[model samples]
Target: MFHAVAKGTPYSWANRYCYTGMFCWWGSTTYRRANSPGAAVDTGWGLKFFE
Candidate 1:
């Protein structure tokens, strides 16, 4: 999905997660529909999620 978006005509990258947090505590992250590839997209806190 990420590759396709990056290569598609619009030419964009995908953000795997959105920033959700409090003053110093990070909360849940939401996936972005379309973000740019090789772009500086931050998912936050170096956290990992599994299905």
Candidate 2:
């Protein structure tokens, strides 16, 4: 689905993280939704949801 966002190689390089404690949160390349291809473990920290 994301491969059609720009029309390039349908790919990009980024670092995404998922946390499940205190307040789980995720991070990635700020504009494009690159959260569909990574995973993370809980460290008992911050806020948000992960894909």
Candidate 3:
């Protein structure tokens, strides 16, 4: 269902590394500490890291 929502369309940046890495990193941090600050803000940080 997630894959279907993020189908491999050309403009699907989320289907690409931008969102992929963000969520992956987010999960990593959340796994370490669920109450981590700026987790949501880190999405933009992760996107910059990937790019």
**Candidate 3 regions off by >4 Å?**
1-33, 40-51
Alpha carbon lDDT of each predicted model: 0.39, 0.37, 0.33
lDDT of 2 by residue, 1-51 (tens): 021223344444443233333434555424334457654332333334333
**Judged by lDDT, which candidate is best?**
1
Q: What is the Cα-based TM-score of model 3?
A: 0.13
TM-score of each: 0.19, 0.17, 0.13
Task: Let me know the TM-score candidate 2 reaches against the reference structure.
Answer: 0.17
Q: Which candidate should be chosen as best, given TM-score against the real structure?
A: 1
**Model 2: residues with Cα > 4 Å off, grouped in runs:** 1-13, 23-51
Name the lDDT value of residue 11 in candidate 1. Answer: 48
Which runs in model 1 stand beyond 4 Å of their true positions?
Answer: 1-22, 33-35, 38-51
Better candidate number, 2 or 3, judged by TM-score? 2
Per-residue lDDT of model 3, residues 1-51, tens digit only: 123223456655455532332223322232233556745433122212221
| Tens-digit per-residue lDDT, 1-50, candidate 1 | 11122223564455233333433434565445456675354454533322
